[model samples]
Target: MDRITVLLADDNLIVRSGVRALLSRDEGLEVVGEAGDLESLIALAEELAPQVIVTDIRMPPTFNDEGIEGAKIVRKRSPGTGVVVLSQYDDPEYAVGLLTEGASGYAYLLKERIGDGGQLSRAIREVAGGGSMLDPEIVSALVSPAKDSSGLNAEQQRLLLQVGEGKAVKAIAAVTGQTPGAVDRAIGELFLVLARDASVGGKDALRRLRSLHTAILEREEQGETLSRMLPSKLAAKLRADPTASSRTERLTVTVVMSDVRGYSGIAERSDPGALAQQLNAHRQQMNAAVLSEDGTVMQYVGDAVMAVFGAPDPQPDHAERAVRTSLRMHELQRALDAEWQKEGLEPFGMGIGLSTGLVAAALLGSAERVEYTLVGDTVNLSQRLQDLARPAGTTVASESTVTAAGDRWQWEALGDHLVKGRDTPVAAYRLTTDTTRTEPTPSREEATR
Candidate 1:
């Protein structure tokens, strides 16, 4: 039997090398080519025509959308080529976008699992065989109950969930004991209820279906079961558990800051209607990318988006996701620019920053105005990092963020500097590929300070 040919694309050399080494042990697989950037990966796909391409979502030069864009190109050029995207975390919006374009011959897996060579090989084989694979976690996130209920009626929401779990209309009918036709009609109604305004007619129906399906899967995996009324006594007992309270204790978290590069300039030049349209488009793209990486959009301050990770739910890899999202956002901006140019509008740019440290993140403010948010020097530093980014650019992780990210990504010491309001200067680094780099040069004040 012919060995399955594979092309690997990841900005991190160590990750690519590790994956290649792992696959080398599999007799059925062969790593035919590799790329560290998006453009090269596309070129390699065209040249090698590999049976499979495993790509990282963010790659060098322009880190964002490279993997997805490359996958789309491979599908167009070599319809038989299977594309498996490896991301640091599952992004539902990204998954939705990919599936909407056509889900066959593709897979998206979390990078953490690449070590499971058998699973990776199996996924490759599945996609090469013309099947689709989505991270169960991503599927659950997309279809969370909150999202399904955002615009859907209770019945429509339930139907959407069932359909998203890959249930056939007949199977749905069997479960609900309704006729297949009725189930199908219910699905249609559900689609209509959730369809975006732009999807009123034409190809939008399919998009709506895909979105609903993806969302449902996400919710299911998150263990978000249907709401049930727990006995009041039991609920009170559970809430009174001291361990649960202790578990909620605050910890250091990474904060991500992003903003349009030239919001004021754009507002000055364009009419309110045009500016609103532009801002909406930008927001959608950013929201999709951020949410896909499991980052929460804390709030939108004018044209800026403040997001947080490592809180609400702490994941050891949150800092890595934050950095990766920042890179992807930069890439998305470029793609959006090309889109805007087609409409004769100026290209918009973005700036992003990330920082990690202990911060107080909990419900605060007056009873009526209470909300969940993070507050600390770390948060301020993250905001300052965003301020430091050049238009259409990004800066990542103060020394604290890098420490928290552990070994998930490569780091290069960019040196240390004093941030405003901090008594002492802090060490900083540029997030390199996934491999670790040498310690940054010691601060000039190492002895003095």
Candidate 2:
């Protein structure tokens, strides 16, 4: 007979209004209060002690990761309360992070799906009943080949899979007929298996847990969830030194970069809201394609995406996977164009490039400012390839990538090209759908006009 109390946190008034309107139609749900930023959300969560706190990823002030941080605060302060995170984007890393505390009473939904009242209500009820929910898109992103070898055990993997589907640990336990204690123990064991120590007690344990929680939550909140924050080069080196007690492994990877064609022109011509919607659509399509091919999207840079293969987890076929993903991304762009045309919008295209090489992959920055990213010539080359894609009218790749790809893809040698910073001229290639044809040569006028 009692209504489910809900605290809504979102910087956007319209989104909050829309969510409130949708939930209002449901008799079992009640909106307790609304907060426009992380601080207010945290304070309200503490004060209201709502059954569930639903929040958006972006909020006021820094707008970087307020929602996720607020979620952490709520989890720490009100263990009895549930948290549901909503975002326009599907970032699996965030879901993983939120569910890391055992995937009970946690949910992540794509904002676009708010219109689906039934789905939204189901998610709310699921989390309220100590269940988890994640957008299908987020699940796909987290299961990529690059993440396949993250060394997660059966229990952790199962937890992730269940959480991805928005099923809570309690629900999972009920299905498996495992006791709640057993499920909780399994999650704790998983944290240990991930090289995170759970032995330390008191303030140290709490601090570590908070740190880990923040790391995972911020990723989801900032749309950077796919990548794991690793220690910085200096810290890693220090940890790896024989004199130091800490030990960690380093990984090599291939980086892929994709940028929208004529993005600046589009942004300049379109309203901010329209441009954002367009970019969001483009990112959704690109993310789906990339995840389907088993690659991790590291970050979104304005109109571009930085993705990686074989760092968080190494695969012998990482280079090949990255190449295949680039090809598929081209197809995705075309598909998106058709969708745009149907909606009476102008079609825009995407350019993607990939490069493979060694890099020190790890979480970089201070404890308060850490981010997981790859650093090396390979990353730089990938960006350069994205830039080179313009005049060629297709994705381009460095010679190293071509060699790595072998005969699987059709590539035409563009000859040794000069790239900034490197003394030696790097051989570049124009990626083509057809391997039989020689590389096409276009005049300056043709390329420009």
Candidate 3:
């Protein structure tokens, strides 16, 4: 790690020297310049171009908001320079005001707490690395009065506070007993929600969001994109119950099982490169369709895509959503197949199954590779129904799914068939509506495009 260049600014000479002495003690920090007033601070910032500027919240002739004004000017002039504001009071408004331009590369700490362990050093390091931190005293003061007004529950507020205090994703996860991926997803969602609030100030919200995004993206020491593994809602659930992770709950949900028909034959006959491309495109289309309807993709096993609607986060219309997703998936596959054919590639045919009933859902396996698993008749029956779609491009649903989905679809009763797992026969329904209508998607290409 390169040493962080620091510039100290304060009206009092004693305070400036003390800060410089404290920060210089760390080999990672280098005190390059000092300023006693706002004018000098701005001049030295331009002259030295320090990586970080540690200054009092109020200073100079007026002693009003010169520190903040100077910091903003410095930020505008030097794009990546971090500003650390030291205040004598516990007011959250000062910290709030400092973050008006943007949240990236900023920190606010009470001057009295500078001697409390390594608070000053931590703030400097956090701000230097494009992270924001607020004093705990300031956060506590703000969280209490706005709890009921903002509609944020206790957990959300706690998470927000942790973010504001400059805790890294893994740090927050450790404190909350949640996975780091879950914390990263929750923070992104929280900031977007907060950014839309008229009272929160859009610029400030965006700043917080931008800073958080930067922090989370760089949290992994090995530079891994860890947060992309799970659905946002699933990650939120992981954060919601970090302690009760492995507990199973009997919940009613809509399960979707899909597989590429004749995948074995296609893989054996087609070129390796072409088959890989086709499978990749198929998965992308399927994932888009499932996520568009707020469904969590359970996993992709070979050419099979399994998705679930409802569990990890409750959706009242899980069955309906599942049906809609199945329809969309079929349509999306058609569009992808058309494109693939135009490029002289083999087309993929998919068979889907939907079943709505009670299933036991739980966070299973271990932390290294945690997974959301569903077990019960619903899951088994759904797989059986998928196998029943012999000709492909068709979605078969269970009777319970048809009932829960109401009269939304033109259902063709497939009658009763004995599923592999059960002794008794199960009545099934096939969605007779044309699945290849080609629903207009927002974009022509995937993210990799």
* Candidate lDDT (C-alpha), each: 0.69, 0.67, 0.76
Q: Pairs clashing in candidate 2? A: 94-220, 131-168, 132-166, 132-167, 132-168, 133-166, 145-294, 230-363
Instruction: Mark the regions of model 1 whose C-alpha exceeds 4 Å error after superposition.
Output: 1-248, 406-412, 431-449
* Ordering by lDDT: 3, 1, 2
**Cα RMSD of predicted structure 1:** 20.0
Q: Write candidate 2's Cα lDDT for 7-123 as tens digits.
A: 999999998999999999998888879999988998888655677899988888888778988898888865646778998767555665566655556778888886664787887
**Model 1 lDDT, full chain set:** 0.69
Q: Which model scores highest in lDDT? A: 3
TM-score (C-alpha) between model 2 and the true structure: 0.49
Looking at model 2, residue 283 earns an lDDT score of 73
TM-score top scorer: 3
Backbone-clash count (model 1):
13
Q: For each predicted model, how many residue pairs clash, with residues at least 3 apart or on different chains?
A: 13, 8, 1
What tens-digit string does per-residue lDDT give for candidate 1 at 1-449?
44677999998999999999988998888887899897899888776567799998877787777788878987886666788988986656677666665565778888787666477888787777665676767656655533434566677768767775666565688889899778777777766665542333424444645664554333232211111211122223334552432233476678888878877888788866455556756765787678778777676677888888776667678886787787777778789789779978877887777898888765445533434557788888887777666536556568777666665555556566776777787676655453233554333234224
Ranking by TM-score: 3, 2, 1
Tens-digit per-residue lDDT, 1-449, candidate 3: 34667889999889988887887678888887889888999999986667789999778779898998999999987656888999997866677677665566778889999878899898887777566667778666554343333745677778877765546788888988999889878876766666565464644555644544454344332122122345546655655666546678888999999998888898888986456546755776788899898888888888999999988777889998998999899899989889878878777898999999888887666556656688888988899999887678989998888778766466767779998979999887777766433443222112114
